[model samples]
Target: MPLPAMPIETDLLLAHLNGQRQHVLGILDGLDEDALRRPVLPSGWSCLGLVRHLTEDVERFWFRCVMGGEPTAIVALSQGTEAWQVDPDVPAAVVLDRYRQEIDRANAVLAGTPLDAPPAWWPPDQLGDWRLASAREVILHVITETACHAGHLDAVRELIDGRTWLVITT
Candidate 1:
């Protein structure tokens, strides 16, 4: 999706997020399994690690945290190491697939619920802070998170092989 140069909502936010997704997708495309899993930075964070983390983060916000209470006990703890070892034995491709699944689920939940519908999950105190958000706000948070991680992945790509960011879609 083509993104706008301005900071407007709706189209701008959606377009920007689509752009970020494209950017990350580009970084992942045409890479071997090793390349995808390789640590491209000094801290050993790989493209796969960032993808997994972003997926989980957004899932928490949009699905469990934003909509309801924590559904599972599997919490993400970043050690900033090679491949991020979420479940050390899992492969990069597996993590990426999990991310894709979570994103779809989160999107569906967000699309089905109204923005003003009271969140089913947060604590009473947290409720006050979140009570007023529209669905737009929730989506904006997702976009912001995705864009931030896309930038991180871009830097990792550059570090790995001096790759530059180019538009993925016109």
Candidate 2:
């Protein structure tokens, strides 16, 4: 179990980050196999695909990209496009569980690290500038990105089953 919460900005940011993550995953709560696989748009990204994408995204961005250093292994290998592609063999349940697990791992990283630590790896452009990103910067970026994806998940969930879970409910 998580220790007692800190009454500070880090806690607030993490709360919002985890909330957005949970919000996106919650969209698939009652969905069946076929329903989860149903495409929200003609482009062919199903609801399951979005969850899987977020799984990789959160893990890759927060844990790997920020915590491990910039341009982590996933980025070196796939350059961020891999998350958008869904594996046909993997089941939706596994994808959902993975997202949940990723979130837990991310929270642990956030909890153990300080917000003021500078990134281990800085982009070439930010090397000498005043824009070096601290752990706090990465955390905020993840929160914002997750929230944006949650909006996408909202539209996809509605298109799939007409349930507007992002705004009206969990």
Candidate 3:
């Protein structure tokens, strides 16, 4: 079958991404400290860790590093993978707030950019210049990344409480 005409790709992308975003948040809803902190993987990442990591990395990598042409990528923790490690002392609620704020900042960056244009360029914290990507590609990448993580959280939530965010209706 031929693809349906899409007048604006960005709007379609944002809609689908936001839908997945909601599910990620939904899985975290009503969870107490134990549920949020319980490790679902042998690697020891909890639900809270996934949320916190996404909160910081989304904006820094996509907006600042790629779109704004900044070299040094700012993250929740400068220590790379440790960014996904959660500190149990902090409330899961706080991490969600930070995620929302970063998303607002990211949205502003998207609003001001022309999707097809060459992304801004700077130099080095980790990324090579060869990895430069366009605004459109970055948006799609963010959506894909968010959706992928949401799937992880879905499994984590189910393992923690035997509950799921998905439903099937015929």
Candidate 4:
């Protein structure tokens, strides 16, 4: 069956955000289980662990918990789970799949929301005076954070096997 065309009136901020998300995933491509789970840097964060962090802290935290006011995400946040520490028993595929699923849910929240809309919930206790007043701010924040982590992944992937996300020839 033929696929439907994407809607013409797409959100510009969302486009950038999704691009960064894809960039993160792209940097993780072609890595084996050991490579994905190996901590190349001194910080001790694996690629899969970074993906898990993005899934929980960035996507689910911003869109589901703060913007959409999802109770499960709220409770999860309250418990302060360490999103960047993946257990040995957890497969790399599981972490990647969870990130993809969280992206889908985050997109759902973004679809019904206006850029100017205030977040439905905020962690006043945890954040203290810090705040993101609108959906636009949140999206921009996520995009920035995702892009930063994508660069981190690019460096890590290169250290793993000399892979680069992009190359320029002059």
Best candidate, TM-score-wise? 4
Which of the two, 1 or 3, has more TM-score?
Answer: 3
In candidate 2, position 5 carries an lDDT of 58
**Pairs that collide, model 4:** none
Mind giving the per-residue lDDT tens digits that candidate 2 earns over 1-170? Answer: 75655549888888788788778878668989888877667677777777777777556655655576646434322244466666778887888887887777667766766788776654455335655367788888777878887888787777777888735555
Tens digits of lDDT, candidate 1, 1-170: 33224324544555666677677777777666677778776767667777777766565555655565444623553334422544558776788778777766665565455555555554346335645355566666777778787878777777767776865776
Residue 94 of model 1 has an lDDT of: 83
lDDT of 4 by residue, 1-170 (tens): 33333343336787888899999989889999999999877768789988888998889999998999874784244244367779999999898999999999898888877778899988768877999999889989999999999999998998889999999999
Local accuracy by lDDT, each model: 0.63, 0.71, 0.74, 0.85
- Regions of model 3 farther than 4 Å from truth: 1-7, 70-73, 76-80, 122-125, 128-132
| Model 1 segments more than 4 A misplaced | 1-16, 68-70, 77-83, 123-134, 167-170
* TM-score of every model versus the real structure: 0.69, 0.79, 0.84, 0.89
- Report the number of backbone clashes for model 1: 1
For lDDT, candidate 1 versus 4, the one ahead is 4
Candidate 2 worst ten-residue window by lDDT = 72-81
Q: What is the lDDT of candidate 3?
A: 0.74
lDDT of 3 by residue, 88-137 (tens): 67877888887777777666666667778577854455554456467888
The lDDT, on a scale of 0 to 1, for candidate 4 is: 0.85
Best-to-worst order by lDDT is 4, 3, 2, 1
User: Alpha-carbon error at 57 in model 1, in Å?
Assistant: 1.9
